[model samples]
Target: MTCNLAYNPRFMFLTKTIRYNLLAILACLLWSSSFVTTKHALDYQTPLTLAGLRFVLAGLIQIPLCGHLLAPLRMLRKEFFTVLLVSIFHTIFLYGTFFIGMTWVGGAEGAIMIGVGPLSSALMAHLFMHDDKMQRRTLVSIGFGMAGVVLISLASKPWSPVGLKEFFGLMLLLSGAVVSALGNVVVAKRKGGLHPIALNSAQMLLGGVVLLLIAFPFEGAANFALPPAFYGQLMWLAVISATAFAIWFHLLSKIKVSKLNLWKFLIPLSGATLSWLLLPDESPTLPSLAGMALIVAGIVIGQRESK
Candidate 1:
């Protein structure tokens, strides 16, 4: 019995490491591919409804697996308000606007905008968070990063051919980027160590509920009923989101938060690469590639400096 019990932990540790890496890779792929999936879904839905439904559905799936953690809901009393605020930042300010902006923004462009997250997050950390501090090197890297984005935008077909609509869309997406960065900083600095799974579950559930409320008045549910043909796609969206969060939180639990943050730089690049593979005709423009390069350079420099 003693020998068997000892062997059990070794087996479990190996299993967990393998599972964690697999899930991390999957999370990246699923999240990157979300740009394409969102594009497909938009054909049959409005951005608001789509955003709301996606989170709500994802939360529903999570509830069953994570129901036990719900008992600790009361434990989060002091931080409950903080969690709610972050939930809004994610569901409304981040993803809500992101969905709407994606209507106007191509996958590649969306990827580039998303890359702004690391830089924005770093800035927020410097200003507001306790753990991270600012430095000259980071500032310089951020400048290069912004320059890259500016060049990409200028080189594009047109920044705003459709008047304020396109302009507003861009603004909204960028705002989402900033808010997302802020949320990351908050999570990093907040007191106490949360079980990543429980924390993630709570955030998603709260965010999804808020999204439903916002989307309901807009009648987002009306777009959800689809024929058998599209059911596969819906399943895909749900699986991708659920699996991504699970893996993401698991990784967060294992690694140092600062090191994990550096990995976010890959998101935009991966999104663009996947978008190119999935939708050949909608390939990234030369300028977008330039932006990708800058984003990468900025992240490397910024992380190096911060360290």
Candidate 2:
């Protein structure tokens, strides 16, 4: 005799995969638009203060939303300090430098430098972390990525006898990349994942405190008036922080981390496109477009071989 049993359909898994990738792309677009928003917001607020507020608000929003997922205080004791350290280095130091650098550099140049994140992350994985071993194809992919970086940097025109101030700006952004690389390695191969929401929230809180403390010393206290449009801008930034991170971390849970990373190639390309649309003076020249093509190609090759 035949018996019937309740079973979930296999297609559910396929549907989920599609949903995750869709969310990932949405996260990318939201994050890309941040470059433009930050540029606009800088007219009213100092970079450090703005960075501080962004994280503070993000943390506040996440606390009530994810508080239940955190481990008990005793269980978190050992990890508590480590999380704070990573937050300071990765979120505060890295973001602080990037914002300060933005004061001197355009969104286009910043996007190109930030686009090298995946390669930097890969190198960090190979050097410091276990279980994220570099494969031969990954190395080949890295070569392509490096070539793209060279082209993008050349297209950015950093050293055409500009003032020393411009060079310092580049240095700050490059430093931000190094810090972000370190964060990636620190996260790679971590056993028994922390609740992403809890972790991100705590770190953002700590980082915000640090950044805010630094803000006043650098920018001084200004009773600056806000334009009517700043409310819209701030709301956009808040949405970028909350929504992008929620979607990104959710995807990380559902998919292999390495596979999800491939979408990073789209970030700078999107940012470049946004800049082209927004800025009258700047557009993607042929070299910039070629650089983006190389980045995308490298990501595809890397993902195929990473398996």
Best-matching candidate per lDDT: 2
lDDT per residue as tens, model 2, 1-307: 6533334455665566668777888988888889878888888888998888888777667766775635323223657775776686668989899889989875446665676666676666667755566677776776776677567656655545546786788788888877777765554434347666666677777787788889888777633478878767867786687677656655655554444655676777676677678778776778977987887787668656232
Determine the backbone clash count of candidate 2. Answer: 0
| Candidate 2 Cα errors over 4 Å, as ranges | 1-20, 67-78, 146-160, 222-224, 249-260, 278-285, 305-307
lDDT tens digits, residue span 1-307, model 1: 2557546987887676567555655676677777667777878777776676677677667655665746336424646876676577656679889888878765435555765765776677677755567567766766666666555545533443455776687788889988876666556554346655455556766776677678777763555467664555666776776677756666655643443445566565566566567665656778878877886786567545232
Residue 71's lDDT within candidate 2 is: 35
Query: Can you tell me which runs of candidate 1 are displaced by over 4 Å?
Result: 1-28, 64-79, 106-109, 140-162, 246-259, 282-307
| TM-score list, all predictions | 0.75, 0.81
In model 2, pairs of residues that clash are none
Candidate 1: worst-modelled 10 consecutive residues by lDDT: 69-78
lDDT of 1: 0.65
Return the lDDT, model 1, position 256: 36
